[model samples]
Target: METVIEVQGLTKSFGSFKAVDHLNFKVAKGEIFGFLGANGAGKTTAMRMLCGLSKPTSGSARVAGYDVQLNPEKVKQNIGYMSQRFSLYDDLKVEENIRLFAGIYGIPRPLIKTQTEALLEKLHFTEERNTMVRALPLGWKQKLAFSVAVFHQPKVVFLDEPTGGVDPVTRRQFWELIYEAAAQGITVFVTTHYMDEAEYCDRLSMMVDGRIEALDSPQQLKEKMGVASMDEVFRLLARKAKRTE
Candidate 1:
């Protein structure tokens, strides 16, 4: 496909601390790219920059063909972002939340209704359309949050630790939703602590102390580290970091 996100020498620093250092990566259209790292590894920082929510202290990034620094608004328009914490009005009915976001994106009322119905049915949330978001279960809320994020048909979706607190089965279901979006030509950029979820991604990058230490398919990363699983690969890479430090 096409290049949905491009980064080169992307760096973000706080005082003397480098939160994200010289990161370089590309995500292609319709691909699910995983961003993996332990806490404080700068994954969030890098993601924030890519999503146009934060600026890089130095270097550059482009999202959906718009330069992040010069055209942050354009970049935001073409991308959807879901944080680990769900961002929806708890008191609003599910459909209302959808309408609110649709309005925020300036979508026409008729198109909003049509798309909302289609998405709710496709995601199996149509029956719960009038229910309060606060009453929904954690898993359902996560799904709704994701659906709302991409309701505008954004070219790229950025999910930051979306399944962090979800159970394994729920996480799998969430990944299924992610797969559906990717199949429909939306690029998925996600950060997660779940190694199994990492395995589901088309490609992944592991960050350490603000820089990427490994970038590959999960299977390839395991092979390179002589490990049996992504968890092992992460452990081995982390150990290497400690030794060098």
Candidate 2:
């Protein structure tokens, strides 16, 4: 598989503090890569840089075939992002929200209608298209947010704690959507605290403080650490962090 994301000696500093230190990794196209860490582990800072939302203090990264620092706009155009806080207008109707995002992504006006219809049908939300987003259940909103994120067919989608605060069944359903997206050749880069969610990724990187402490498939990490589950592996790694939330 081709590399969709490449990072080399990536670092970010906030005055006297270094939020990301000498980070390095690559994400393969169509792969589901999980980024796991405890609170304040610098995952958010690293992702912000990768998504072109923040500038790196040193080093370089290529996202979706564009240098993040030199071509942040191009990087933004090729990727989609779903934040942990759920970025949708609560006052907007389902169809309205989809249209709004379509415009933001620069999807042609002529194609927006067709794309919106297809998205609604795919998520089985055609019946709720006219309803306000705030009226939908949390799970439905989450799925809708994800659909909107990928409506423009980005090369990669950054999901920042996409399953947070959802029920187990809903999280499972969300993971199904992720699998479908990955199968269709979209790279999925996700950060999640849930161990079970971490296990679902093709591979995972666990961050401690501002650096990655371990990177491997979940099963491999568990085996390497002599643990039987991701929860154990995460606990073991998290305990070594020098920072705390």
Candidate 3:
């Protein structure tokens, strides 16, 4: 498979605090790559660098085959990012929010309209097109956020804790949406703390203390660590790291 994201010795810092320490990884085209880490494990910092929202203090990365350091604009054009606390204009109607996001991407008005119809239909949101965004349920809102993120048909979509705070059923639905996107050849790189959610990805990288301690398919990681599940692997690793520290 082709490489969609490539990071070598990636590092980030907030003053004296190092958030990401010498992180290295590659996400292949059409793959759903999960990033698993506890809170403050530098997942958000690494994602920000990949999205071109923040410059890495050291190392280099290429996103969608464009150097994030040299061509941030180009990288942004080819990537879609959905933050954990993503906001849509509450007063705006569902379709309105889609139009606004599509406009921001510079999509042609005609194409935007067509894409909007298709996306809403795909999500069974056509009935709520005229309803206010704030009136939508949590599950619907999460799905809408995802639609907006990839409205411009970006090559890669970065989802930072996309299913945070959602119920189990809704989370499963959200994963279905991700699967649909990956099936269409769009690469998905998501940061998530949910061990069960990690199992849905094609592969995962588990981080500890700003460093990647394990990277592989869920089954492989489980087998390597002699754990029955991802959650156990995470706990086991976290405990070992704590002991070392």
Candidate 4:
């Protein structure tokens, strides 16, 4: 497996507080890697460092073959990001938002039209292309945001709590999209609080108190921790955490 994301002693701090402490991990190409943790476990802080949205106070990370500190812009260009909050423009129509993001990613003009139609069709959203994003259901917006994030064909896509506040059915549907993206060789690095969602990942790194407390395949972690489910494994590890949401 080709390593698409590599980190060594990655750390982040704010004033006297350490948000991420000496983290080290690697994600392979085409992986659905879960960076799992409770709220305030520094998952978002660590994610921002990896996405090049924030610099690490110490240590190093290389995302998509570019050193994060040295080539933040290059790292940003090679990776797609969807934050915990809805990030698309609600005022823009469905098709307009698609075209706008494609342009931002510098997708060629001729291909944008073709790809835009294909995306809408895939989402069963062809008829609502002219409808404003604000008019759509939350589920529809989540689907569209994810599709746009990966439409640029980035080497990696970071999803921060992407399934929050959705019905279980809708969340499962979103995971299907994640599976499809992974199948096409887009490495997915996702931070999620839902242990059920964590089960969908190829492997997971459990974060507790700004550090990786455990890292392994779900089955392996379960066996090692003497647990039957990812939820149990998470609870056991998270018990050691000093942070709270």
Q: How accurate locally, in lDDT, is each candidate?
A: 0.90, 0.94, 0.90, 0.94
Residue 146 of model 2 has an lDDT of 94
- Estimated TM-score per prediction? 0.96, 0.98, 0.96, 0.98
* Candidate 1: stretches off by over 4 Å: 242-245
67-109: candidate 1 lDDT, tens digit per residue? 9999999998899989998888999999999999999988999
lDDT of 2 at 129: 94
On the 0 to 100 scale, the lDDT of residue 243 in model 4 is: 71
Model 3 TM-score (2 dp): 0.96
Return the lDDT, model 4, position 30: 97
Query: What alpha-carbon RMSD in Å does predicted model 4 have with respect to the real structure?
Result: 0.9
Model 3 misses residue 3 by how many Å? Answer: 0.2
For candidate 1, the TM-score is: 0.96
Q: Poorest 10 consecutive residues of model 1 by lDDT?
A: 236-245
The root-mean-square deviation over C-alpha atoms between each candidate and the true structure, in angstroms, is: 1.8, 0.8, 1.7, 0.9
Local distance difference test, candidate 2: 0.94
- For candidate 2, the 10 contiguous residues with the lowest summed lDDT are 236-245
